[model samples]
Target: MDKENARNTTIFLVCMVALLVFYEIFVIGPREKQRQAQQHAVAAQQQAVAAAAPGAATYVNRAQALAGSPRVQIDTPALQGSVALKGGRLDDLFLKGYRQGLAKDSPPVELFRPEGAKQAYFAESTWVGPALTPGPLTQWTLASGTVLSPGHPIGLTWSNGAGLDFARTIAVDDHYMFTVSDQVTNHGTAPIKLAPYASVQRQGEPELSKTNIIHEGAVGSLGGQLRLIAFKPWKKQGDTTFTSTGGWLGITDKYWLAAIVPDQTAQVKAQFRVDTVNGVNVYEADDVGAIRTLAPGATTTSNTRIFAGAKKVSVLANYEKTLGVPHFDDAVDWGHFWFLTRPIFWLLETIHGYVGNFGIAILLLTVVLRGLMFPFANKSYESMSKMKKLAPEIDIIKKRNDKDPAKVQQETMALYQREKINPLMGCLPVLVQIPIFFSLYKVLYVSLEMRHAPFFGWVQDLSARDPTSFVNLFGLLPFSPASVPMIGGILDGPLHIGVYPILYAATMWLSTAMSSQSITDPTQKMVSQLMPVMLLYFFASTPAGLVVYWVASNLFTVGQQYIIMRRFKVDNPIDSLIAKLRGARTPSAAAG
Candidate 1:
């Protein structure tokens, strides 16, 4: 029966792998062509819209485009970009500390692209009223400092023909916050009502990911409630609006964010709308301040802020506390496991702060986790050890009632109860470790800090799959193994493992073998043996940083198990395995 079950399991795994291979070839292979065609249509529509704007030229090189426009240079420790003088728009920004790769000369990560670009994303502000005529392209005259960098506020002034004096002051901080103060003095004979409004809009969806594990589109919070508006599902949701006394709404990319923050103490209207413009998808999030009527010689001012930059956890948390932006730190893709992911991130970051190297921090975190779980794990393993020592008696009981199944079961239960052994206790450690493992994986996948970060030796770019492939002898050979036939892609997908994954496999296998004695059921033992090989392929395509964490975790687990086993004088499989191999080779050695 055990042999039959093993055969069936192997067949199931093979069938699953075959199905995946077929799906990759027949389904995933054709989507690229359709995606490209859609992108071209979106670009053509955007060009038409740009033709009507002030700068009719389509977006070009970021440097050249920035130079073409009258601008106020933005210089901060965390941001380097420009504020367009034409419309007083906050665009053309790059994350100063993030780069395209590990190379020093690699360009900084460009966060905001201009309106005429291939995938235009930016933020704009304006006044909305019956008498207001200020549009997105309205040009304002610079009335203050030339540069709008950190700690420096710049002002712009414009007077409509209708007797309204419009003044705008833009101020940015050392981080990602931008405070905009707008004042309008009513000089007309009659009173006019107006409301301040801000918007963050992106032209077309930016290649919506196929996976739903991470949100990659418009997201916001209103009335202390969080909302995630997926790009693909926006058409179904259609123009969702929320009214709150004070909250923020904005679009969020995987690692960066741009949120419209209204005064937390005042009432505002926030909306997420999808508009089709000339066959292009325009996803936008906007907030409008409450209407206020200004009489002649009366002045009205509205203060609002925007957060536009990398979604660093600490920075977002600080902003939420100081600025009262609701759940701002939730912008980072913590997935559904935020409960576990948040604490794990805080602990990992705290360790990294002291160690100064993220790789080293992961290792220390593994040790700390093992130490914390030591009490429960100790009890579980001790129970398993007692069961292992009772194996001989259990086998005797089985043989004594070989002809009577119920008698055998009764004897085994009696023996188990006499020894106070509970088989369920053995599974407790695995259950406890599952969430920690997943949460760590979440942190490594979505956090920007892990991108392009380096470990010692050749392990650069922790957020990417390991580039080294042992099939080419890890680049020891001049030729590429991918040149081989038939199963090359498969080899490259699950078998193209790096040194870190190999280390992970080794540690996991060692830990599994150490606990082999507890898996006395032949079926369980067989599955345990197969689990390590399956894990090697499973982890092969995961980020290198995650593999590092797994390897460290397994190593700590192995050490902890070893200590407990040694203390209780339990048998270890490493020695038993060696002895069995030696015995099997004895006849051949004697013959030689």
Candidate 2:
């Protein structure tokens, strides 16, 4: 048994090392190279854009881009930016409620930048057709209202020399939605055909989370079905079109979204496409309504709404409910388990309302979930405690049938049946936890509410990885270990385990060790012993909030198991350690 256990441990260690090496080579290295290449390409593109322009700045910043455009200021309770009057484009925007970082003076979260900017992203609604229609460089003139706000609406007008006059009225809510109403009146002798079109365009790719859990690219709901194409896939496809009535399309980041919503009752043709401009990839999501012929002395109007801001669940749900934006809440990336994830988010948000802290809310949410699953957990722990009590009998059976594995298994089954204990019962709690774990993970990863949320000491951003690294001695060291030259990447990547991850691993070890004490099989016992260590490495880079949940859950499970084991008078790790400590103390007391 000793030889077999040692061999299994050696094999396991070798496999783990091999897996890590393979992952580092194939996954991390390529991703890092690709990211660096993208950054360099974007910088080169910006330099080229600046060079190509006549006497433009060497590198155009956001302020420079905003100054380049003739604009109308956008001021609202939730947003602050401007409308580029050159195309009447909703181009420059920043979320007032969110910041780029947790610093007290960090800039607000920028949602849009104008065409001349490094990462130009904007939304525009216009008329398109046979007759001269308003285009991006149409040079619109503001015809009404000054600052665009919740109550104030602005009007922009442009007239083609061919006698087609276009008028657009832009209005915004206190939140993220912008209503663009376009009217075109033909003043020519002949009738003209025109169609309403709306587009959300992005010039270059922004830094993405690159995680599979949360989607960050072109997302839409067409014909009441959700469609998602990630950035790489979106680039590869080049162009994707859908014909549907009452749907929305947009580009989404993990927490931000820029979407165009056509009239819910209107039949529209929408397309998600990517174009390379001067060697830079430009992604666009656009929709156009059916062409309508305007007779002489005829006036037609079209209304389209654009959503550009943080993906707040309440805001998206309100728009979906009140404005009939189909699947607007899908912008949050609820994943395959939306039923559970959405409810979990709602519960977390609800709890947060009362507690006034998302960290506390997460703790309370875990407690509630565990309480709901208490019956199953109770049964599982009871069965485990009972099995621990039968360890001696099982050991005896194994030793008696040492050479015959079938006889050992048969006797073990017989023993379990006699004890009225189901050996598989322990798996029930773990199985139940899988979906809940994934759901809560999704909530923490994707929900805007969890972003920049704080837990207790050292966790300022729940959505981000734990900032306290063991390599830096949990921030007590003056110098950052990750800042070292040669092995910095390694230190920052895998070896940068954090306090929460360590706590979680320790709790998991305790729970797993307690459970494994009853296992007589060498391989199974070895696997159980290594499970917590593997999980510690795996979860080292996950969000601090998720680690908090796992630690809390493990501690709760340990407490439950301890109580059940004590009640059953089963030998467990806690009691064993306590008895050993007392034995050591007894010798010292006798010596004294």
Best by lDDT: 2
For candidate 2, list the clashing residue pairs, or say none.
none
TM-score of each: 0.87, 0.93
Score candidate 1 by TM-score against the native.
0.87
Native-vs-model 1 lDDT?
0.80
> Per-residue lDDT tens digits of candidate 1, residues 1-592?
3323434664465456556645544455346445668778866866777777764444566566566568887888888888887777887889988886778999998878776555678887878999865776777888998788877899989888899999999999999999999889998999999998999998767765444557887787787778887887876678998898887888887788998888889898889999876555788999898888899999988888988999888899899898888888888878788899988888988998998888898888888888888888888888777777888887898788889867876777677788897766766787798888888888888887787777787888777777888998898987665676976655565567878888888998898887767765676676676667667765777788889888887887777777777787888865677889999999999999
Whole-model lDDT per candidate: 0.80, 0.88
Off by over 4 Å in 1: 1-68, 208-211, 479-491, 577-592
Each model's number of backbone clashes? 0, 0
Tens digits of lDDT, candidate 2, 1-592: 3324434664576477558755854587568867889878968766877688765434467788788768899999999999998888999899999999999999999999898767799999998887778888889999999999999999999989888888999999999999999998888899898889999999878888856788999999997899899998999878999999979999999999999999999999999999987656899999999999999988999999999999999999999999999889999999899999988999999999998988899889989999999999999889888988888888888789999978887787787788898777777788899899888889999999999999888799999888878888898888786688988776787677899999998999999998876666677677778777777776787889899888999989999999999999988999999999999999899999
- What RMSD, rounded to one decimal, does every model reach? 4.6, 3.5
Candidate 1: residue 181 lDDT (0-100)? 92
